[model samples]
Target: MELKVSSRSHGDHTIVTIVGEIDLYTAPRLQSEFTRILDESTTTLMVIDMSGVEFCDSTGMNVLLSAHKRLRERGGVLEMAGPRPAVRKILQVTGLDSVFTIHEAVPEELLAAEPQA
Candidate 1:
């Protein structure tokens, strides 16, 4: 399946919604989106909405790790929300569940808040 990536700003956070499979062919697209968001947005917090992702491979995981590292280096945070069972298992097996702040869902407060000026 084709990978789809999009983002929206909410308060101090940027919520990136991703769908479809993330693998060798799709990971670059995800990486491109992350690079764009990092370079353009001023927000220090990013929430990755992973509820739509049905499959994610090692390349996809690496892309996520790279984004997380980059965010941390700039004193920002990268959060994962609503990962499906398979992705969640991969994270757990890889020990990345401990590294990332995984959420059951994107926080309601963040979605309801007005974007920061």
Candidate 2:
């Protein structure tokens, strides 16, 4: 399956919606999208809506971690929203569940109102 990414701005944040499998072939696509968002300077809060992702591999997790680290370095944040069960489990097993601020779903304000820790 192919990876698909879409986005919308929520005030000072951007919500990126991703679908399909995220593996070796698709991780770059996601990384590219993140680069574009980071370059555009529209928001500092990057909310990834993974509700449509069916599978994610180690590469995918690496991509997420890289983005999370980059955002944190700049005093920004990377958040996961509505991750599928498998993806959630990977995050838990890898101890990354604590690294990211996760939400059951993308909240109304793109979670900007909440403190980013």
Candidate 3:
């Protein structure tokens, strides 16, 4: 499936909404999207909206980790929102649920209002 990425920033936070299947074939596209968002301006918090994700694989998980790593390198952070149950389970089983900050697809204003960890 095709994944469409949309991005916007509020203050120092940039949020990217991901809609569609995320697999090896589309992970590169996600990476490119992130690059573009990062290029738009300086930021320290990145939020990924996963409410529309239909399917995912280990490759998709790797993409998530890469995003986290990318933000960390800049003393920043990446948080995922509303991951589907299947993907959520995958992340949990891989012990990554604890790695990526998660929330219900809320706005950045209220997102940080409640920290997952």
Candidate 4:
């Protein structure tokens, strides 16, 4: 489908809304986007908005995992936002629901999350 990365600031954190299916074809692009952001050293927290992702295959899950792993090692964190029921089911079945921080698409006070040092 289509992907849109919306950047916003909540205190010192950066939120990016990802709207699309992150399959094999699109995963690479998303991966690259993360790498670029990481290199910039401007984003301390990355919130991937999965609210618009209608379908996600294993490849897509892997993409998210890869990003999480990378961020963890780098002392950063990547969070998931607004996953639909289908996608949520897949993540829960795979036991990734516990690993990732999931949030509803609501108005929350985005505090300045700490960066990995």
* Clashes within 3 Å, all models in order: 0, 0, 0, 0
Q: What is the C-alpha lDDT of each candidate?
A: 0.94, 0.88, 0.84, 0.76
TM-score of each: 0.95, 0.89, 0.87, 0.81
Query: In model 4, what are the clashing residue pairs, if there are any?
Result: none
Candidate 3 backbone overlaps, count: 0
lDDT of 4 at 81: 85
Clashing pairs in 2: none
- For TM-score, the strongest prediction is 1
Per-candidate Cα RMSD to the true structure, in Å, reads 2.2, 4.8, 4.9, 4.8
lDDT of 3 by residue, 1-117 (tens): 898988877678877888999999999998888877776768798888898998888988888888789889989999989999988888888999899888977565745644465
Best-fitting candidate, scored by lDDT = 1
Per-residue alpha-carbon lDDT of model 4 for 1-117, expressed as tens digits? 776555665554667667777777787777777777666665556787788888888888987888788878877788888999999999999999999899886326563343434
Model 3 poorest ten-residue lDDT run: 106-115
* Candidates ranked, most accurate by TM-score first: 1, 2, 3, 4
lDDT of 4 at 54: 82
Clashing pairs in 1: none
Could you arrange the candidates by lDDT from highest to lowest?
Answer: 1, 2, 3, 4
Better of 2 and 4 by lDDT: 2
> Per-residue lDDT for 1-114 in model 1, tens only?
999999998656899999999999999999999999999878799999999999999999999999999989999999999999999999999999999999999988888784
- Candidate 1 lDDT (Cα, 0 to 1): 0.94
- Deviation in angstroms for 13 in model 2? 0.5
